[model samples]
Target: MAGILPKLIVFMAIFITLLTVIVDGESHSFSKTLPLRSKKLKREKMSHLHFYFHDIVSGRNPTAIKVAEAESTKTSPTEFGKMVIIDDPLTEKPEATSKLVGRAQGIYAMASQSELGLLMTLNYCFMEGKYNGSTLSILGRNTVMSEVREMPVVGGSGLVRFSRGYAHAKTQWFNHTTKDGVVEYNVYVIHY
Candidate 1:
């Protein structure tokens, strides 16, 4: 009888603890939901996409051209803009030159003195392929010496409306003499 009494008491104590926790949780939820029920719902549809961008920007060979602006030399830092074209690597040949894809135009404002990065605002226009007539733009700073730079995508137009996300760019090949390099981009796009 003594052992049974102790077991019954212990079981009652555990049951009481569980009941208290459940009651407290229900009361708290009721109190919190009253204010939330009056609030308006803001929901958005988000879609994710990934693609690769290969660019060969050059100043000498003229893949990327400098505008007729003031003191826009490559060696010394200057506020300048350039127009660049990117062709699809898969169809890159003399006869398949019409299979162009990207046209990136942007300006390079000297962002910092410490690392030599540019305050870049680039409009990447897709001229050919499945994403033709769409434009994805990005605004961020990229250091000249950085092997990889991740930048935020601002917005987009055409099929990619209301786009926002991030992109990673790596300088694959660079020429110090001609001020040109091949940049590989892995872009992540989130849009509605």
Candidate 2:
């Protein structure tokens, strides 16, 4: 009976150690191995998408602008134009478009154009309720444009800098030309 008890203890210890190793191995593998692949994929996708958006924005397309504007208006109608909402305690009217532009310019001076573009893309994703991990395939009709703006937080103490802007479709049937050669459109701007 004494010998049998000792053997049982040894077996149990070995079993527990093996179990722990297996569990920890899986956890380590997932965190260390999978993230590398995931991050690489994300970077690759973002690079491809950046080029695509840049092309579309630089391209002279009127239809794309109309579609983007329509989509932005449909998604965020209340926040569409500059307006004073004195009655609403939750919202504060922005100071001015020029002020927002000034803030953006300051931030833009510090960052590279690619970084700014990435920031704008991220803002659009947040406003659109799209996951950042998801791929953005820009077709002729589904193009995006971004504008940078600085706005004071509605209730917070400090000002929040953001790329608040909109995107438009470049190949829609109803297209309008802005004073500049660029297509005129509205993009869902991010507050943060």
Candidate 3:
């Protein structure tokens, strides 16, 4: 009788909880708090990474290419409406021949008709030691002509899971003739 009483109490509690959830129209919620997958990073940690991004659009083997564009994009002063898909290499140094650390794979669109503003959506996938297989996602506005542009680090995967931060990009070199450039990136991220 005592064992049956305990089981009945538990069953009644569960039923009441379910009834309340349905009555409040919260039964559709498919969300619940769960423990972290890995407890190795119990405390939040900050990471600073420096790298050079090579955007090669004009080379025979281009890393970035215009995948789509509006009819008026070619005539537009800012090349507005043009969309570029990039698999640009992230190198240790400004030179393209330098050691490869990862690749910036994503797309950017000319979101501004008046200015050279781009809507960047990319993932910085690291291949170097310690950060191998980790990726940090960036989604923000980038005014390329600015001396230094800041963008948000929205989220990430692998070692960078639950990461959020910002990145500073400064154009190190740009060639008008080739439409190629090297942008230095200093990224700071916080993760747990």
Candidate 2 lDDT over residue span 1-192, tens digit each? 989999999999999988997887756544654554543332211110110111121244411122122334344423232111111000011211111111110100111222221112112111112332222211121112333222221111011122223344231122235312222222333333
Output the worst ten-in-a-row residue range by lDDT, candidate 3.
32-41
How much does candidate 3 score in TM-score? 0.84
lDDT: worst 10-residue window of model 2: 101-110
Please give the clash total of every predicted structure, in order: 0, 10, 0
lDDT scores in order: 0.61, 0.25, 0.94
For candidate 1, the TM-score is: 0.56
Evaluated against the true structure, the overall lDDT of model 3 is 0.94
Comparison by lDDT, 2 against 3, better one: 3
With a 3 Å backbone cut-off (N, CA, C), the pairs that clash in candidate 1 are none
Show where candidate 3 strays beyond 4 Å.
1-30, 36-41
The TM-score, computed over Cα atoms with residue i paired to residue i, of candidate 2 is 0.19
Q: Worst 10-residue stretch by lDDT in candidate 1?
A: 87-96
Cα displacement (Å) at residue 67, model 3 = 0.9
Best by lDDT: 3
Off by over 4 Å in 2: 25-192
**lDDT for 20 (candidate 2):** 92
